[model samples]
Target: MLEQSTRSERGSMTGEEARRAVREGRLSCQTSSLAPGYVQGNLVVLPQDIAGDFLRFCQRNPKPCPIIGMTEPGDPHIPDLGVDLDLRTDLPGYRVWRDGELVEEPGDLLSHWRDDLVGFVIGCSFSFEEALLADGLEVRNVAEGVNVSMFRTSIPCAPAGPFAGPVVVTMRPFSPADAIRAIQITSRFPSVHGAPIHIGQPEQIGIRDLSKPDYGDPVAIRDGELPVFWACGVTPQAVIAAARPPFAITHAPGAMLVTDLKNSRLSIL
Candidate 1:
């Protein structure tokens, strides 16, 4: 386990060290602002039968669903994410959906593991958040200790089999200058949700109200800041829920899987 003796040590660990702690059940909580420069992922587990279709959906809709890494059916580890990574147990919390409705919320998904289950890791906002912070921009969600605000948008994702629905997005309010910097910084990391899909007007993306988010926490939007929207990994979960597959699993929002890969490694340039 990574010692939490001091904040510095906890903050200094390589991305893999942090994942090891999560896999051992030593840390099962929000990963926000942790593993400062490493990639953090949103996980989706599905039966082998439908995994191929889901992959196609992701391929067609890369913005909301970039595939960072995936595991073979029934396999728990994604060597690319971390040698110690176990899809069934590494994430802090999981949502078990049966026939498209959330039925159980578990800290880990060990018991639900099936012989035909496959795990897909979607790039998350956390990856880009690291990039923003590195450039000295304050990430409001981290500063406020809240999950990034997410919403079901008017944008429709490319349909693949049963995986088709309106796209969902996460919001972060920023000044014009900072928002531009965020775009530039995040653009360099396409694996972690590349860049903002929309900016300024929430209603422009079918988000009628900024104060009421469909998922996660609502942050204060002060004067002069625009709500920048990024295609969110949660879009898959929402689609799965509406499609109502017999069984599906997703990492609980904000409670993500920290991978061994550094956020810097995700940069395109």
Candidate 2:
């Protein structure tokens, strides 16, 4: 867990500053609280051969795979996201997968860059967190200095080519009133996974244990609070694994690419 005192400092950091810290090896932890108003994104890199299919997959399932930015074949920079955003190194951590299995968890992707790779930056729920906070609702993972809990659900995504898999969701416990407010607040930010897909009853979504999440860390669910679920950007990792792509790369759960785009810019209102 991170010190609560640094929360303010992290919130004050610019996207570039946070990315620089990750690149310089100064910060390599869950980025839920850093660059508070900036758009943080989940990273997915695939070979040019399969990139088209993956793009269609994202288009088919916009809720969990909303595309915020994308890179040309073999390119590392996304000019719209950040002037100096290097997809190869901006994120704090990365997962390397081969034949549908995780093979490495590296801090940087310097050695893995290839001419055939294409990068995709998927909109993350973190971008809407600021709105939630501004509305006076607590974002538990940020308060506890832990990654938000994520689970694989029985709900299936609309498949595109080989990218078929179950929907993945992030859980945040909230009072019934706050949950409704949260839904209203997040609905304006559709690019960052708009609203809750499930309000309560974890088993209805096939989540057997709230304490044991499929990805990320579980947080306390206090009395009178309902476990609200939102579509997660981590859905791609699960899709990639099921598709058995020969090679793929993704941001580690909770560690995302901090973009220059502000979270407010994503709101429709």
Candidate 3:
């Protein structure tokens, strides 16, 4: 077991180190601002029997389910992600689902691991959020030390097999000028959910209220600031819930798989 320590101590560790901590039970919390500069991902593990359909679903909806890394059936190591990465434990948290209904949020998936399960790692906004912060744009959720606000939209995802549901999105409030810069900065990292899906009207996207987000904490949207929405990795969680697969596993919202890939490497220009 890794030695448990304070958040401040964990914050200074490298992505690999952070993942080790998670695997050893030394850390289990939202992975938002931790492991800075590395690409973080949303994870979805499913039985091989249904993996093909889910893969197609992600292919059809690239914005919300961009593929970053995938593993062979029952294989936990994604060498391209991290040399020693263990899919069942590298993430800070995991959500177990049965027939699409959430069963539990466990610290690790050790007991649940099966020979037929396959892992899919989708790109997450944390990669681009790092890019935005590097450009001096403030990410409100990070500044306030909270999970990024996420909501479900009425926008329907293209159906594939048993997977189909509304798109899920994460919101960040920014001044008009900053919002423009954000769009430009994020556009360079399409694999991690590029550009704003919607800029100003929250209601237009079916977000009834900014203060009451469906996932993560709500941050204040001051006057003159617009809430910018990005297609989120959490979309798969919604798909899993709606599709009700016999068994599935996913990283808990805001709790991600930290990889050795640098966020800068994900940039196209």
**Model 2 C-alpha lDDT per residue in residues 1-269, reported as the tens digit of each score:** 34332667787899998888778777777887788789989899999999999999999999999999999999999999999999988988899999988999998999999999999999988778889988889989878878889999999999998999999999999989999999999999999999888989999999999999988898998999999999998898789988999999999877889999999999999
lDDT of candidate 1 at residue 220, scale 0 to 100: 90
Best by TM-score: 3
TM-score of 3: 0.93
- Alpha carbon lDDT at 183, candidate 3: 96
Question: Which ten-residue region of model 3 has the weakest summed lDDT?
Answer: 1-10
The TM-score of predicted model 2 comes to 0.90
Cα lDDT of model 1 by residue, 20-89, tens digit: 7777766656776567887888888999999999999999999999999999999988997888788877
What is the number of backbone collisions in each predicted candidate, taken in the order shown?
Answer: 1, 0, 1
lDDT of each: 0.85, 0.90, 0.90
Clashes of 3: 1
> What's the CA error at residue 213 for candidate 1, in Å?
1.3
Write one digit per residue (lDDT tens) for candidate 3, span 85-170: 99988988889999878899988888999999999999988899888888999999989988889999999999999999999999
